[model samples]
Target: MPHVSLHTPIGDVTVFEHDGAIVALDWGWVEDQAQTALLDRARQQLDAYFDGALRTFDLPLAPVGTPYRRAVWDALCTIPYGETRTYIDIARIAGGSPRSVGQANGRNPIPLIIPCHRVVATGHLGGYSGGEGLPTKRWLLALEQPEGALL
Candidate 1:
């Protein structure tokens, strides 16, 4: 695995790649300091994003998971930037029930790039993998939709 760590508004992000595609993107308060060519590019992009200069990520990712999980991740990327989708909505789109979508969403590896944070509960902000909990989730949603115009 090839890994790189970069800074972001949410803090340090560690992007791991396997066989030329990203396998995971993790958020942490601190990360093991190491640098790579890929890390440099990822850092640049992440900085751009946090600075509100970039709206989309253009990085190769290959998260390893079951077929269903892979399908879920693929469907997740279809979710446009600055938009939120309910678990039920994603369930119908992914051809599964809401509970299944929740399961898959919990397993999303590349969080921000895949944009799993864009999914919310039917009437509230949903869970987040990052340790900061709902506040982090709320902050991310706010970053994507600063005016509270999430739909």
Candidate 2:
């Protein structure tokens, strides 16, 4: 597995690749294993995204999951950065039930890159696996919202 780690607004991110396509994005300082040019480029793109200079990702992705989970993650990739959607909304879009959508969301291996943090509940911010917990989730949401939009 080729991996690269870089800094982001939320925390350090580690990107993993398999079969020439991105597979996972986790939060942590990367270990000193081997690196590749593709990993470097992925790190650069992630940095640009955290700096608000990029709104879309252009890397090849090969996330491993079931057909339903892949469909959920694919739909998640289509979610614009800084935008929040309810689980029910994603369920409707993914042609699954709300509970199933939540399960997929929880199983998301790529967080910031695939933007799983963008999904929220109807009345509140939902769960997160990243640093600072729910506060981090709220910050990401606020970062995408217009000034003074945070409550």
Candidate 3:
């Protein structure tokens, strides 16, 4: 596995690569760093995303998970940038209950690229397990929010 750490507005994040595909994006820096072309590209994409210059990610992702969880993550990816969907909405698409969808969302290995933050509760912001938790989720949603728009 190869990984690279970079600084971002929210905090320091390390992108992990396994078998040439992005495997995880973890919070904070890791002492053991291995730079690869894919990791460098991932960093560039992440930088563009944080700068609000990129709306979609073009990278190969290989998150390790069960089939149902993969379905949930795939559904999460369908959520467009600057838009949000409810757990129920994902459940409808992924063939699971809202709770199950949320569970899978929490376990997502690749967070920002998978766009898990785009999935919110029906009437409110949901729990987030990445970065600094809810604050990070709020920041990400705000970043995606169009100018003069309220999230």
Candidate 4:
């Protein structure tokens, strides 16, 4: 596996590659960095995303998870940038309960790329397991918000 870490608005993010596909993205920098063409592209895309120049990611993602979790993650990806969906909405799409959908969301290995922050609880923001937790999630959601909109 090769990994590259880069600075972002929220914090340091490290992207991991396995078998030529992006496997995971974690908060904080890694001590030993391994750069590859794929990793470089992922970094560039992430930079563009944080800069608000890119709305969609164009990378191969191979997040390891169970079938159900994969289904949940696929549903998460359907959530458009700058928009949000309730956990119940994901459950409806993924054939699971709200709680199960939330669990899968929390377990997502690729947070920003998978767009897990776009999944919210009904009437409120939900728990986030990446970066600085709720604050990071809030920042990500705000980043995608339409310009001039209130955060």
Candidate 5:
């Protein structure tokens, strides 16, 4: 596995590569890492994302999960930047309950790229697995919110 660590505004995000696709994005850095062209590209994209130069990620992703969870994660990808969907919305699309969607979201290995943070509780900020939890989720949503886009 080759991994690249980036220091973003939220925190250090390290993307792990396996079998030529992004497998995970965790917090923190890895010293004496195995670097690859794929990893280098992922690093560039993540840099662009943190800089707000990129909203959607275009990378090869193969997150390990069950079929049901895969569907949930795939549904997460459809959520546009700055926009949000309730767990109920995903439940309808992905064939699971709100609790199941949230659980799947929690288990997502490649989170940021998968855009799991876009899934929220009804009228609530919801939970986040990064940047000290909900604050990080808020920061990410705020990052995507356009100026005056607010009502």
Candidate 6:
């Protein structure tokens, strides 16, 4: 596996590539660092994303999950930027309960790239990973949200 860590507005983010495609993204810097062309591309895309310049990611992703979990993650990618969907909404698409959808969302290996941050409770901001928890979720949502829209 080859990985690289870069500083972003949310803090340090590390991206990992395995067998030539992006496989995971994490919240902090990691030592024993390595990089590949694919990792480099992922980092560039992430940087552009943080700058509000890239709306969609073009890198290949290979997040590990069960079939149902993969479906949940796939549905997450369907969520457009600057918008959000409820766990129930995704459950409807992925064929499960909101709790199940939430579980899979939490397990997403490639968070921002998979756009797991776009899912929320029916009328509330939902949980998130990374160091800051709900505040981190809020920040990601705020980043995608238009200035006039309430976060």
True lDDT of residue 120, candidate 5: 88
Off by over 4 Å in 4: none
Error of 5 at 96 (Å): 1.1
For 43-74, candidate 1 gives per-residue lDDT tens digits of 78778877777788888878888888888888
Q: After aligning candidate 5 to the native by TM-score, how far in Å is the CA of 114 from where it should be?
A: 0.7
Q: What is the C-alpha lDDT of each candidate?
A: 0.77, 0.80, 0.95, 0.94, 0.88, 0.90
Candidate 2 lDDT, 34-145, residue by residue in tens:
5887777788787787676778888888888899998988888888866778888888888798778878888888777778888888898778777688988877777767
Tens digits of per-residue lDDT, candidate 5, 17-57, equal 99999999998877878889999999998889878899889
* Model 1 lowest lDDT segment of ten: 28-37
TM-score of each: 0.87, 0.90, 0.98, 0.98, 0.95, 0.96
Model 1: lDDT of residue 27: 74
What is candidate 4's CA lDDT for residue 4? 98
Clashing residue pairs in candidate 3 are none
Model 6 alpha-carbon drift over 4 Å, by segment: none
Residues 113-132 of candidate 4: C-alpha lDDT, one tens digit per residue:
99999999998898999987
Residue 57, candidate 2: how far off, in angstroms?
1.0
**What stretches of model 5 exceed 4 Å from their correct place?**
none
The better-scoring model by lDDT among 4 and 5 is: 4
Model 3, stretches more than 4 Å misplaced?
none
For residue 98, model 2's alpha carbon misses the true position, in angstroms, by 1.6
- List model 3 lDDT by residue over 1-151, tens digit each: 7999999999999999999999999999998899999999999999999999999999999999999999999999889999999999999999989999999999999999999999999889989999889999999999999897987
For model 6, residues 78-139, the per-residue Cα lDDT tens digits are 99999999999999999999999999998999999999999999878888876488888888
